[model samples]
Target: MRIAVTGREGQVARSLLATAPSGIEVITIGRPELDLANPASVLPALAAAQPDVIVSAAAYTAVDKAESEPESAFAVNAAGAGAVSEAAAKLGIPVIHLSTDYVFSGEKLAPYVETDPTGPISVYGSTKLEGELRVAAGNTDHVILRTAWVYSPFGANFVKTMLRLAETRDELRVVADQRGCPTSALDIADAILAIAARLKADPDPALRGTFHLTGTGEATWADFATEIFAQSRALGGNSATVTPITTAEYPTPARRPANSRLSGDKLAATYGIRLPGWKSSTEIAVKAILKNAI
Candidate 1:
């Protein structure tokens, strides 16, 4: 099967390309070739690739920066996403779009389900929610996979940031009030490929809709950093002392959700795919990064 993914350098797109199964052709487009912000580039680029399925992985992901640049965020996350879905619809192909757990207000005491009413707390969340709506409206054969706390060896994510900071700092203060699952980009890529294969084989209505795809467990930023240090220590890498702090202590332009945990029961029931625990996935990513560093 041929799969066309957006954002060649993104964490998810890179993971998909690196771990794609044999016998599958994966073509990635980004920047000059397929800029999500430019609607005119969507159809022609996708048409030339002629993919069996489209994975809409590109987005303006600067959470704090989005607060100052809402227009750019909407242009890429909302309108650009809709344009991709529309192109997929015209080509009569399925499009799997990655979304965020930020869609929720994060007030729920329990993990969020797909049916939960959305109440984004920040510009990033709001734009992602709008993108979800637009993609659904543009194409019926779409799978909106909402994930959270994504990190991997590639890209500028929490894991890499923590490691980089540890090089100079003796102690790091992380927000303890905010809690969510730390999903590995590699795990997400695996799920996306599985979904693509299934969609290519069978266009089941039961499979088309929104679904929560994340790591099996949850943790606060403090807890996540602590684990990262623990894993790094085991790998003979630099480790820092993690100090837990409240969200109010460290303010940002964008207000983060206090609890953005998403349940993966629906995805498990439908796709029979469940991601590994956050700790295991973190260890895998940390080890990979450390290995590459040496």
Candidate 2:
């Protein structure tokens, strides 16, 4: 299958390029070719790529910075996402759109299901939520995959941030009150490929819809930090003491959900796919990032 993923450098897009099976052709389109911020650039680029499917993985991901740049976030995440979905529909192909756990208000006592009411508390979250709606509306063959706490060796994610900070700092303060699953971008790449395969095999209406796709386990930022440090220490990389702090202590311009853990049961039931536990994935990422540290 020829899969055209948006953005050549985003974590998920890079992971997809790295992990795609030999049988499938995964192309990463970016810049003048397929810039999300430039809607006019989308359709022609995808048409030229002639992909069997599209993976709408790129977006304005700066949570805090997005507060000051709502227009840019909406332009890329919402309007641009709609453009991609509409492009896919024009080509009569399926589009797998990556989303976030922030769609929820985090008020639910348990892990969120696909049916949970959405109440995004941040501009980033609100834009992503809008993107999901637009994708669904734009293409009947769209699959909106909501993930959380994504990290990989490829980008400026929490794992890399912690490692970079730990290189000089002995301890790190992380938000402990906000609970969510820490998903790996590499694992997400694998899941997206599998979902794309399912989409290719049959026109199963069951396969297309909003679903939660995250790591099997859950953790707070502190727990995730501790896990990263454990992996780093084991590999003789930079490690730090994880100091637990409440969200209020580390406030950002964007108000994050206190609980953004999303359940992957629906994805498993629908596509028969599940990502690895976050700790295990974190170990892999930390190893990749710190392989040459010693």
Give the number of the best model, judged by lDDT.
Answer: 1
The candidate that wins on TM-score is: 1
lDDT values, one for every candidate = 0.95, 0.92
User: What clash count does candidate 1 reach?
Assistant: 0
How would you encode candidate 1's per-residue C-alpha lDDT over 87-194 as one tens digit per residue? 999999999999999999999999999999999999999999999999999999999999999999998999999999998999999999999999999999999999
Candidate 1 overall lDDT versus native: 0.95
TM-score of structure candidate 2: 0.98
After superposing candidate 1 on the true structure, give the runs of residues whose Cα lies further than 4 Å from its correct spot.
none
Q: Candidate 2: global Cα-lDDT? A: 0.92
RMSD of each: 0.7, 0.9
